[model samples]
Target: MKNYNLRSTDEHLNNLTSWLPNQTVSERLANTGFNIKYFEKLPSVINHCLPLLSALLERYDSRERCFIFNGIKCGFFLEDVYYCTGLPVDGVEVTGVVKSNNDEKEEICRMYLGVSGLLTKGKISLKNLRDRFINAEDTDYYTRAYLLYVIGSFIVPDKTGRSVDVMFLEQLKDIDKTGTFAWGAALLAHLHVELETASESSLAGHSYSLMIWAFLHIPKLLKLLPNTGRKGPDEFPLLVQWTNWLSLDLKNNFHKNLKSKFSDILDNLKDEDIVWQPYKNLQNLPNDHPQHRENFLCRTVLICYNEVVYHRPDLCPKQYGIDKPEYSGVRKEIAIYKKQRKLSGEIDWSKYTSEKGKVDYSKYIQEWKHRSESLLKEALGVEEHSGPTLSSTPSSIGNVRYDCSNTHFEDDEPEVEPLQPPPSEDATPRTQADASPKTPDDGHGSGGEEITWNTFYLAFSGQAHHSTG
Candidate 1:
């Protein structure tokens, strides 16, 4: 537990390079490229190291350390390092620092930026993070989630509106499997919706596309969500069912091709896809490219969704449902996705809107048996029912045949012996003494009494019949 609070510049400099005394700063920079182990260790030294990083960044004539302009932080990129102010303090918020300009500073800047690149989304999107920090063989859900969070931190959209970090949008292209890092991806999606719905500019349209991306990935997201950490048993399943209902509801409200259009947007997003920028708007985006059509499809789908929720007010959950979603950030995401999708169309008043998907609460309940019988059978290596046998006598009850060849000794209950038919009137009745030793008691007259035909039949059925004198 090393103390993270470093007060002075000397202390900061000392803490930053104290690990290796013999090797020069230039030596360390050339050797260390940046990995998870180093990034995890940054927190303890970040407060101290950032000032040195800022000073080093100033050495590059192209880059300058601009922490606050007009009392607000400007989003500045120092080679690969990103610095911002007024957002959640990820590393260090530089207030006051001395500036230095020289070629010698470049080596230190390279070392700091290498680590910083791993943090910032502008430098390392989810795709870059996966390639750099995570090994190709890794597939564990928890590990992917942890990595997504650490990387997602720097994606904080510029609240100052000075510049927009749209590089995070590249994550949409790499989301091949939503279930792998669902919770983390959901959190990131929620952040986008919040920013988009809050805006009144053309950026809102792009934000809508991000929301649709989240919707498209809902299937994998639902499947991967860890069940135990949820607030209630119904929460997780109910979310799935609700998302399912809303997805179809939005599609049915518009034309069925809206579904295909949504899919088209996903399919077209590539590493080279053109995303809108703060400095240069859609003006730079050519009308002929694949990116143009992708953006068009996104807006088209968004317009359709918003129109239905607008006129048909009951379709919005906030107006009617007890479970208001605004608290959890879901309502805003859903509302924006629905709101931005609004387009001009004739209202089909007769279209079905009442069928809300049902949540299987029992499936998520911890105590309930969620594992299928087949799964248990496969695990235990025991067959539930034996294979069919040769034809046998049918039971008197119905068409069910009692196959004697396939006898089951599975259940604990004792088997009953077959009942004998009633004897004819002329046949002599056997006394109890003459009966076999294994014969069960008739529960009527004493053992010495004669066993009558009616008595035998009644006893076999477990019902006694008293004869009239």
Candidate 2:
């Protein structure tokens, strides 16, 4: 892993550090004393991370549950979690569950859940954190928004299904109304994109489930946005990110082998039982937005099931075309979705327009300009800004070493063989959608096999299958 300077003074870093703790990173790390390698319980990790957490609350001046934490605007927390333990940031066994038999791995998992617990429901209410800093005149709303997001990302509940806490749903709605945390929404959306890309079966399946749950509930936030009429500032970038990930995943066959397992699960479900709660909850959203989420889900399922229906037929008896007949090529639905959304792989933020806030994208616009200049320099073979990338020596934070060189770059980068160029805007469209399950004599041929609701639920919830893909 290449280690970038943590103290580098640049337009981006300056903007970020402006909202960080008053002290330097090293000073803050020392104040936290988070140098333990193995924690037997989650409380231990919480106790250690509290200083860092407190510093964040002190920076944001609002007594509220919502804040944003773009990994860029704020220093990343997952890496710190990894620093506390030797565990890979990709996490042990992707499911993120530590095996009971392995004391060390189990401890790591406990620590992760524990840290999340502290942020969301720890004894010190995040409300209290806000009160402490609420009087600061120089409070950075962007930082506050990002901080709230950091806390929310860890807000996943223990149960899956209809058992989600009512408080959480209400909290999501309240936060969404604020409209200051679009960056958080965008970050969670990006997580969903990452999950789809890494959908291969592995321990990572558990990580995927956590993200899926986040996606499932995000509509609660989306539905509550103020009447801006336009999409939030983060929406288009997220869409572009999602499409690029899918395009790249296809090229690398990331979802190829695992596609059959989804079919196996889907084929066992009965037509009437395919309704997922997440899809049903979006009823209050504008027709276009909710439909888009549904389309994404259906398209993803089609990709997994290796079944497609070119166009959703009106004559189909089923509520969703997912369960009915209509034959076309695999991944065809996804292709059409990409076309309708105009999700080109490249995101030109310069062309982005949103009415969310005053100076809504001033910071991002600056960053984009910087990036463009860097590219121009690279093109011209200029070395004006060149310098050696300095990495930090290994230092034990908790149990794991914080050596910058050991970062999880390999785990994160997509493994693509013979990398393919991103698809051009004018690239020829592919074949149409494949057939979904359907009964006979429906004009279209009978959809091959039917899948039971129980089967799909089991696979999706990680009860029947351990892998994600």
Candidate 3:
């Protein structure tokens, strides 16, 4: 087998590091003295990879789960998953059951899990490593968030039918007054994610704590005002008015205080038009505006992500989507928008035009809709409407390595030969001469009268037969 990059998983994952906490197998190997060809059960492999997975979870303040595909580079097949061992990850498999036979593969996964749990609990937190500086709280959040997202990706792809319980996320729902705001933000984001994206099969118990508040309190976070007129989606205050802080006079100090680490969260907020010139005027605000956390500005970022990131992750500023971006690059963009909003005092509303932040939104949704012209033609398979494209080359997609030879039948040139031959006139005359002309067969000879089908049937009568099942 070709050596597919066992690093594919690491690279795909590493691509997201610009935004979130990052730890790669390559980096871990370098740090822990792990030899690429060493035994699968080496101490360094376990010691290095375990806590690394744990630390990535909440590392950069995002909660995205993406696949780290080393399959192509590592020469993996679904069948090989049971044998994950060796390094870089030669031909070993890391999936399937890791517990039953006490297999080496299982042991490794178990070790990784244990390390992750410990890191999330914080005994293994890192301080200032490799010129990259992070505080205790920042370190804890990123590590935990990254691990959970990675674990969740393992549990479900296509974001469906999750079996792993991320109850740990619920543990992060409440932010203590002096520490990480990750708990509350995660809780709220969890609610939005579950409500908007979780598969029905997933219980979403991890987010049970915040779903009510999302329906009740979160719209207020979108605007610079406080919520009024009471509860629920039906009674939701205007998205623009929710954060309007009748107490806007209280200094809009949501993020300026050193105690709150919420600036990271605000920075991660996605905005659509910030890229093109169209919405460039939106973030125009005064550099010293009293509001440190602008609700309307944050909401605009979400709107931008909803437009640019959701439909196509490719369009997102970073591979990881809305939660993270290349930290420095994204922050620069946010700073620009901050300037826009502080100076302009409003976003582009002439186009959307509802009384407040609600635009019926359907008009914007219509922009991306596809036309339905050929669907009927396609269903009928009409060549005029849906003709097949001609290509001389073979497709690589769906190509299987196994042979295409027929497995079911014996090969023989049977179609060209007759099953039975007619007797010649001379032979017929002889059988008739024996008196077969008056009956179905000649009773005397030619072996016809001597043998009976009944005798033949009895010889094979005891052979076994399979039941219909």
Each model's backbone clash number: 10, 31, 55
lDDT of 1: 0.19
Q: Point out where model 3 deviates above 4 Å.
A: 1-193, 198-211, 214-297, 300-469
User: TM per model?
Assistant: 0.18, 0.22, 0.17
What is the C-alpha lDDT profile of model 3 across 168-212, one tens digit per residue?
332223212112111212222222222222221222212211212
* Native-to-model Cα distance after best TM-score fit, residue 182 in candidate 3, in Å: 3.9
lDDT of 1 by residue, 1-469 (tens): 0011111211111121222212232233223211122221222221111111222122111101111111211212110010000011111111111112222223222332232334231222333443443433323322332223232322222222111222222222223322121121122222222221221111111111122223222222122222312221111111212222323222212332432333333334331232211111112211222311111101000011001111111111111111121211111111111101111222121121212312111211211111111110111221211211111111101000000111101112212222222233345643322322221112211222111100000000000001010
TM-score of 2: 0.22
Off by over 4 Å in 1: 1-123, 134-146, 149-234, 250-469
Provide the lDDT at 133 for model 2: 40
> Residue 184 lDDT in model 2?
22
Q: How high a TM-score does candidate 1 get?
A: 0.18
Residue-level error in angstroms, candidate 1, position 161: 15
